[model samples]
Target chain A: MTHAVSNGLLASDLVKNFGSVSVLKNINFSMNADEAVGIVGPNGAGKTTLLSALAGAFQLDQGSILLNNQDVTEKCASARCNLGVVRTHQIPKPFDGMTVFENVLVAASYGVDADKQTAYQHTLNAIQLSGMEHVANRQAESLGLLDRKRLELARALATQPKILLLDEIAGGLTEAESVQLVDTIKELRRQGIGIIWIEHIVHVLLQVAERLICMDSGEIIADGEPQAVLSNPQVVKAYLGGGIE
Target chain B: MSQWTNSVTIQRWTPSSRYAIVFAGLVLVLLALAPLFASNGLLDRLTALFIYVILAAMWNALAGYGGLISVGQQAFFGLGAYFTIRIADLGLDPFISVALAALIVGVISYPISLVMLRLKGGEFAIGMWVVASILHLMVNLDGLIQGETGISLVSLNHYDSAQRLTIIYLLTLGSMAGLLALLFFVLRSKTGSAIQAIRDNEEAATSVGVKPEKTKQLLFVIAAFGIGVAGALWLTSATTFLPKTYFSVQWSAYMIFMVLVGGIGKFEGAILGAIIFFLVETWFSSTGVWYLVSLGAIAIAFSLFLPKGIWGELERRFNWHFLPVGYQVVEKNKINTDKK
Candidate 1:
């Protein structure tokens, strides 16, 4: 929250291919640290792939990613996370056999390079922020789906990320649970952490995201205000026509 | 809405765990004094059990905690023995050679880990075994080893039989205790958490800033060093090193059986598994092939029924944990009230 000169995340000319199929093509995306952006698309829209590329999950075929105006194309996933870009998996990937508190502790200790006391404090704060204090001592693998999703958010928050990339965090949650998650995400955005959420839940995503981007066939077809992007003809044809009731 | 309380304290050691520590220390001290009263054969058997403990614990830390199921540990075991003999041939005391050989094996494991760690799952297990086989063939080519006729550590003959046996027993015991202590401390630290996180999910760990490669490499090297020391001590006690016997895949099989019988991921399980294995081997050695067949049968039975191993089952049923590898969060007010 105290960052005075963060330029946020910038990705230019990103291209990625898997075998004979192209997943992402010539993508250019940018987001500031003070805004929340939502990405919505049909299946195989390269939305998650874009997030993966930004998070450095795999090598980009051709691209340059800049975090705070510094190129991070060569950095590995952990290195990118240390530089203030963190992500949550679409399906929760909690560290089994560890307590929920310990899952976030790993992020604070390694992501921020915090010492024991600082890391512990950060872990507690992340848990409290994500409303996971009740099950803080429980093993992560024992958690239900909603709590598991919250754990993913708590872990990302513990990293003290400037740009948080969330990949369909509310995919399988009930409507009430989705509302609760939206409240937590709203709180995060208010605290000045940028979030780029990829979701299939449009109305829920619209509650928190000021801006929205839509992609189809590995290319962004719409980028603007949430309503404006949603109403775009190409976006509707490529995504919302088949999705969104 | 009420403000969330953030005054919880993390507790790692319970009263039972604290008492367990004292009990373990007492047991170690009592075991250390065994040679003073126990017969030579018993002392020899105890020494062999200590070596099994060392190997099982190292493999447990590597495969159990690190998610690296390696069967090629005998490579380091054999290399450790060979290095000790080679170092002793230069006129060094065999005791010092044991330590030096272990250190050299640790260094050698770094490069080997670089190549081997790239392989995952079954590939890693089989790849390590292949590497061990290659090392065996290479060791047989050495002039000193003399094409599998092997070589004896003649340097050990300088000491009287009683002195040599006593020293070797002490060395093996010390190494087992030292390695366990090392693992305990490492698993209790931040790096320990990182390693476990990587084990559970490598890509997820990276998103949280855990370096999988570096953490796995450290564990691989540590396992090699400890297994190496065990091999060096074994050669010192036997005073002989046959390339075939030293690099035998049977060593890997022993480690797997012990970890499976005791518990795969628990520290106490490895020690427990090693002891059970030592006893089973002792009682059934006369049964020859039946000994190995029963060993396999027990391993299979444990896999089918007690898959978590004995320690894991006990912990699951009674919620008992003697080691401090995990954290327990308690509210500060609860602690204060409990004391009152």
Candidate 2:
């Protein structure tokens, strides 16, 4: 096992299995603060599962997760969120009954444990950052696809996370919408929040990702600079079989 | 050059909510002053209405906001009455026993909630009924209760009928008001948001740092406490301690009916539904089985036509919020940049 960084995220020998199938096998990953890393993989490559593990959605069957050198493998999802590890769902899951502002406020209030005034401020700022200020008072269930996706991002942002795990937040959007999401992610990178983004859209990932990791059959096949990893023979064959357009 | 900036303000009250506050104050004043002028019969009916309100509000907070959808709250209600009787037997004033009994129910419900709250959806609903049945059987085993023969709070015979009527009325009214106010403030607080968030989507709520189990447990315990008080208050009025009467599934049915008819999730809807149910029972209860049949029919109709409930429809159409338990973000200014 490599030494855990005191100011970043680290995972070593991570193993997760579902019944007899090993969804994630011996996964070793690490990222520094403010580093923007993108992950691309074929279907069933365990990208989402990896994000879920890091976010503490469920306990790992093996290995460990370290957030800022704090062993967080045993912590629950909410505790990890409070510890500054937050994630957005691949499929947007807003609190349908709550307004956009209220949805974000939940994260600010509980995720960061901000007081009322500070939570309100953070909620407003997150809404503004996600370009959702216009519909801040609108019911979350009433949002269109793009707005819903933005809401997912805004909610995660309100957590004031040290490390953000984004799972295909830009999926199923038009090219223009994708570009807009990329711009927001770029801004987040500028603010020095460590990000591990998983997206199938190779071009969008290249826009904000300085480093890239490619996975095949639940194993990291290539890890390095975005262009280098994308062009790796194993990655091209496993993920981008038709080659990047 | 002039520059514009947007300032966001968080406010809970709108014009409708302000009007609602004034209206609620007026109603409370009238209810408080009722015993002075109201007849014993009128006071008796009003007390029943208060109990119904308590039951509806408690169930609404549990199933509507917390998403527990328990069908066994009667367990606490029955326990409350039984404990009140037991405490009175131990030399405490029965009136004081009511409060003490409800507190005991709250304490015991924590452990119960830990076990029962693990069951979800239909399992939770039926599991609660089973728990109620178990408690009912346990109470039956007590020699003092005398099984189906039942027991009565004979200690209350010391008060004259008029005095008993007035005291019970005041007690029930005061409790109903206090519980409503408590619900209002709780729904407005951050904890209120946590429970509602859990109801919306438990997994999503957890990812945002809201502990679903802990939040649900708190709500469950509170609902049990309030329902227990309602049960004890009901016993005070009836002056009877029939386990069959207090622990019946009918109480849970009534709660479900009121909450569903009024609007399942809306705070005002529960109150409105309780009032409607109370009025319906007062008018049509003489019709025998048809009255219950009609209630079932109304609940089904409401479920089919207005799943959000009557209050939910009204809110959607007229944009009225009698109890604004959520935040509204007001954009103070809009910035416009002309061609540079």
- The 0-to-1 C-alpha lDDT of every candidate, in the order given, reads 0.90, 0.89
Candidate 1 per-residue lDDT over residues A1-245, each given as its tens digit? 11223588778889999998999989988888777999998899999999999999999999888888898998999999998899999988999978898899999999997889888888888999888999998889999999999999999999999889999999999999998899999989888999999998899999999999998999988898988887788887885465354
What DockQ would candidate 1 receive versus the native complex? 0.57
Residue B305 of model 2, lDDT score: 92
B1-340 per-residue lDDT for model 2 (tens digits) = 0111136577777776888889999998999899999988999999999999999999999999888898899999999999999999988888999999999999999999899988999999999999999999999999999997899988888789888899999999999999999988888899999888888888989998999888888899889999999999999999989999899999998999999999998999999999999999999999999999999999999889999898999888887887879887764442121100
What TM-score fits each model? 0.96, 0.97
Tens digits of per-residue lDDT for model 1, B50-165: 99999999999999889999889999999999999899999999999999999999999999999999999999999999999999999898888886899999999999999888
Residue pairs in collision within model 1: none
